[model samples]
Target chain A: MMRAVILAAPSVDALDNPALSALLGLIVITLIMTLGVMFATWYERKAVARMQQRLGPMRVGPWGLLQPIADTLKLVSKEGVRPASADRIAWDLSLAAIFVPAFLVLVAIPFTADWFVSPMDLSLLYILAVGGLSFIGFLLAGWGSDNKYALLGGMRAAAQLISYEIPMILSMLAVVMVVGSADVYRIILYQDVVPLIVWQPLAFIIFLTATIAELERQPFDIPTGESEVAGGVFIEYSGIRWSLFQLTGYVNMYAYSLLGAFVFLGGWEWPFGTDIGWGYQLLLTMVKMALFIVFFLWVRTSFPRLRVDQLMSYAWKVLLPFALAQIFLNGLVLVYDLPDVVLLATSGGGALALCWLVYSVVRVKPRQPLRMVGNVPATAPGSVSG
Target chain B: MPFEALLENYLAVFLATIVGTILVATALIGTRILAPYSKDRAKVTSYECGMVPIGRTRAQIHVRYYLFAILFLIFDVEAIFLFPWAVNVAQASHSAFWAMVLFIGILAAGLGYAWRKGVLQWNR
Candidate 1:
């Protein structure tokens, strides 16, 4: 009985009591997300500023470490002006609807082998499902604002989000098929010998594109494109509400980066194996996550915003078919009991094909202007009226 | 039990939601306390790049968005069916693979038809 108790204790999680674990996990994760988002804001500004050849926020604590805090303080103290005609309930609910899920996804993320708010069997699915709900908040914000720009931005945001979600889920489906598990922990463990990126480069590429689109970052940021919509859905928000939305965006960046790290980059498993202590596990996870974040920031500073039409077309036409093809290939291999090298060959070929497709599309006649240029008669054939 | 473990895991998520709500509520209240507020009619009116607003805020959207939404609904459901098949594909037989191939083939066929119809074309 004593030996049995010892073995059982090992099976139980560190914080075995559910209620206490929930409370403690919530507090720790909340604090981390808040501080991490603040740091991310500072990091992004500094990174983007450097890329543009300018010093960013040098006045605050050494190297402008305190800039995000100062910005937060200013935003918090500024008046939150709600438009008189805005829908009360929708506008109010949008804030929490967007903000909470950004924080809630942390509950299932395994920071290390043993360190997690909860070790879930279906963590990947849970995160995807929870993350998808935030688009509803965007719709509500857009409809409730009683502003045309907000409504336009909201519709684009909703449409863009739903479109990109398909490719993201499909890419994840490819990974799940290869690993035979939807549990993120097991998926990471499967990569102990070899990371999935080698076997499913196509899926990795698809996931990367979908991640950028879903985040609504540069190139895919039509919903909030400053030049076009002038702050889009966020146009009518001010003060704390505005800051919260911005904060949620950063938090989501962190969340998706972490997800990418765990799924594609092998999380805390590869290179060092599972025997490493918690400190190394934590280090590995953070470093991989930082790689993703930097790539995101780099992409943000580099790419021009894609046209809405191009964005939607690419997701549905190009990415979706490729993603589905990846699943089919994986199924074919798995059922045939083929060696792993076959996966690399097939997926690598698909990646090349995808690249060629993009290159060929670009090489073709430049995309027609949405309408004929200035001085075209409104009634002229093939001319569009705004 | 498996069910018990599942409940324990999700209980944390539930608590996280509640805690998140409290945290956001506190921030809202804190902002209310810290921020200065004096309402003005012009300030409350909808923003129109400094112009007095013109017409209805809720205008009719294009029909294409609704059409794309219907397309999305169909594809999303297809994706849902694919997930379980994906998880068990390794142990499953060749017949299962062929079944999925047929299912996805039909999806691709529909997508191709949409493309041919110019439903995927945004400008149209």
Candidate 2:
């Protein structure tokens, strides 16, 4: 009954008729994702432009609404080529490989209370597992291109992702521990009284950082670091092939924002304590997602990229410990039936303390350079290489 | 019926994924066919900062990254163990919570070993 359609009878019918619902949901979500990509591209440009005190995309259409279309057309018209030595199959498949997982996660996302495409009970797990597979596409892209830079990018991306995944899941586990279900809708329901962000700001921040790393966004985008590795995994791609990667990135950006909104900002639930219509419910969810998108854009424009090693350490030493603290503290709070303030104080204070401890420990050492075991010449008189 | 309903949900997800993939592929193919394609040896050759490409592209990878991968597999499996416990948190006993505590502690110990071994250090 919770799945009843909002605003009008049309959506309700779509929701009730299981077969028809799938078809309609596909169409709707596809349109939404495409439009989101278009809009996000423009939004990112404009936001970055304003940050630098300049106008962006003013000529094409009203507020440059047509910019993305022009960009897409340009991409399609450009020639996509493969290197002679490239793995043709993997090179060709990489675009779709990157694309498919993002869209699948989209299908699992709850757009609104009644407008969900597929409200799987295990939505969190499904989204995490499926979305996490995009790194494979990056790996394939790197390996397929037969370029050293691409391989480096791909490998760095793999490392970044592997390191970040631990903290990301650990942070999400805190929420799961509290809610007791991986179902996104159920998590939302548990937030009826209060959103998890208010309850666990530490986890929220950890997740935010982890997600940035996961998406390979600015400050964590070593995989596609343009200046260093020449577009990293995407070094060999051109034309529509390249655009597909861009599309996947933008769409997943929106998807992650949607996930963040659902998990932490209370999904379609109105924070203002108002019972709105279904159409408004959909709109509210969108608005929340849009806010998160802006936050992502703002952070992207503001921060510089972390060095590969620093990035890994940040995950393993800093965010990982905080995430673990979130779980341990939550367990204590649950078993002891401690007051809610205890949860807030311990998580917040614990995060600060852990940050300082990690920074102090890591900073003092100021990491040394790496050399292979055989590379070091033995200076000792008894050594073989002396 | 509900189980079928559940399956129907996943069916839609798979379908959506297919549709999205097809849409992208169609665009790529359309571009591939329509775009001007006049290639030379230079155009198709591998790129490396505009030089005659050196040796092999596939370099031997450092064991550091592989170490992270090995650790990821271990932790990811351990993380999966939480779902069952989390799915029924309402009736979780003191013992149930403590089990999680012990597990996390063991994981932390492993992490400590990694840290002490300089596995967590990036530049070194």
Q: Largest DockQ belongs to which candidate?
A: 1
lDDT of each residue in B1-124, candidate 2, tens digit only? 9878767658887687778778877887799688888878889888786776989889999988888998889889988987687666547898888877788789889999999998887667
Q: Which regions of candidate 2 fall more than 4 Å away from where they truly are?
A: A1-17, A354-386, B1-6
Q: Tens digits of per-residue lDDT for model 1 on A159-246?
A: 9999999999999999999999999999999999889999999999999999998899997999999899888999999999998889
Interface C-alpha root-mean-square deviation of candidate 1: 1.0
Measured with C-alpha atoms, the lDDT of residue A296 in candidate 1 is: 91
User: Could you give the TM-score of chain B for each candidate, in order?
Assistant: 0.91, 0.89
Error of 1 at A142 (Å): 0.4
- In terms of lDDT, the best-performing candidate is 1
lDDT of 1 by residue, B62-114 (tens): 88889788888998899889888889999998888898899899989999999
TM-score of chain A in every predicted structure:
0.90, 0.87
Recovered share of real interface contacts in candidate 1 = 0.84
Q: What is the lDDT of residue A3 in candidate 1?
A: 50
